[model samples]
Target: MLHRSGSGGPAVVFLPGAGLVGLDYLNMHNRVAELTTTVLYDRAGTGWSEAAVLPRTAAEVTDELLELLRAADVPGPYLLVGHSLGAAYARHLAQRFPGEVAGLLLLDPFHEDLHARVPQEVRDRLKELESQERPSPTEEQLRFGRSQMAPLFASWPETVRDQLIEHHLRVAWRAGLRESENVYDEVAEELRRAPALPDLPLIVITALGRDATQDQLWSERVLREIHCTTRALHADLASSVPRGEQRILDDAGHGFLHEDRPDAVLQAIADLLHRVEQ
Candidate 1:
């Protein structure tokens, strides 16, 4: 794993969404660098970490994370921050290693089983991403052909948006789709057995809207594509996890962290940390 360490206090071990590399978490890393120490590492085969020779299960991913911590000598009482697809792995880690995890900050995480319930179009897009047709784009890099993805970055500022697009551009093609699927498969199981975690502080940052600022390019019609309502996923997670709290950022879409309002993301972290410390 390629680990990026920021000096300070309680370490924040960041995991990227879906197939993204550890570099995807640079925004959080830069901000948290001064507040507390943090470590950002690519999942095996994705970033700096070499590819694994065998298929991996959810249990194996969690175990690998534990091993990385030991290998890097990252002391515990850790604050885990995972985004989108990465949230499933975070939940597993907190459950499997209760003594090591201090808190969890889940940013618009995938609801797995809920994912299966998503609209056909969304699911189709996901499938396309998984296909061998082309490599997946980084959260940052949506270029000439990829400009269509620019709408997703609409909520983020200039600098944050640019780096993310560049990061997406730099990822290896094979690593994006193939490895992402493996993680998705593992996430499927995590959904089946969403373990009751420790009493450690847990904060879920939920995305809930198609903000008006979005251009005509964005469809306004209500999306009833997902079989399960977003509300249902929210309820299931709240019930299944221990000491969990949900905070919805009104009018923010799926890419809540990178959109027009980064301060909101920053504030969410600051607040979660404050609650944990208190």
Candidate 2:
């Protein structure tokens, strides 16, 4: 595991979205680390981390994370900032190891019951992914995908953009595809089995782009419905916890929530840290 620590108060650990290494979150990490110690590490099979046995469930991944932290001698009562699928892991960690967690900030998270909440078409696509063997992306495919995502990384420095694209194409894509195919259902089931999270500072940041219609073609209907469903689920999740708060960032997509709205993200962290200290 590759670990980078920044100096300060309580540690803030970042859990990257599926397939991304800790470096993928450099923009947000740099911002958070300025105020507090920050920890970012690659999961097994991603970035510099060596591959581990596959088909790992959320509970298993959580155990591995705890072991990594302990082995590294990183003291906890940590503030966890999890993006996308990582949010599921953060929630599981908090549920199972409440004392170790100080706060939770979930960025555009996937709901444990997302499969049930989304439309049939969306569910069908996810099932298709689950049934098929993970496809290796060709150079042409990678280039095309990167081109489509160009606008998102336009704000990042040239070097960071180049490095992110290289990492995504060469290392993250295949591992992410395997994880999605092998353990998605198991992870969802694991989250379903988790008890409600303990009372703590919680922030659920949801991206609700005003022009989401422009982003879809064949999946327009499914996408619109999914957005509504996602918002509702997050609201319910926030309400379930004592100190939970939900914030919607209009015109923000999943990537832009941290990259574009760093201020909002930092504010949420600041607020959570203040509450924890109090």
Measured against the true structure, the TM-scores of the candidates, in listed sequence, are 0.75, 0.89
Off by over 4 Å in 1: 1-5, 53-55, 119-132, 135-167, 170-174, 182-186, 209-228, 239-242, 256-260
What is candidate 2's CA lDDT for residue 139?
Answer: 79
Write model 1 residue lDDT over 235-265, tens digit each, in one string.
Answer: 6676556667787766576544534445776
Model 2 Cα displacement at 261 (Å)? 1.9
- List candidate 2 segments past 4 Å from native: 132-135, 145-161, 182-184, 210-218
Error of 1 at 203 (Å): 1.0
Compared with the true structure, all predictions reach lDDT values of 0.66, 0.80
Residue 68 C-alpha lDDT in model 2: 93
Per-residue error for 167 in candidate 2, Å, reads: 1.8
- What number of clashing residue pairs does each candidate have, in the order they appear? 10, 0
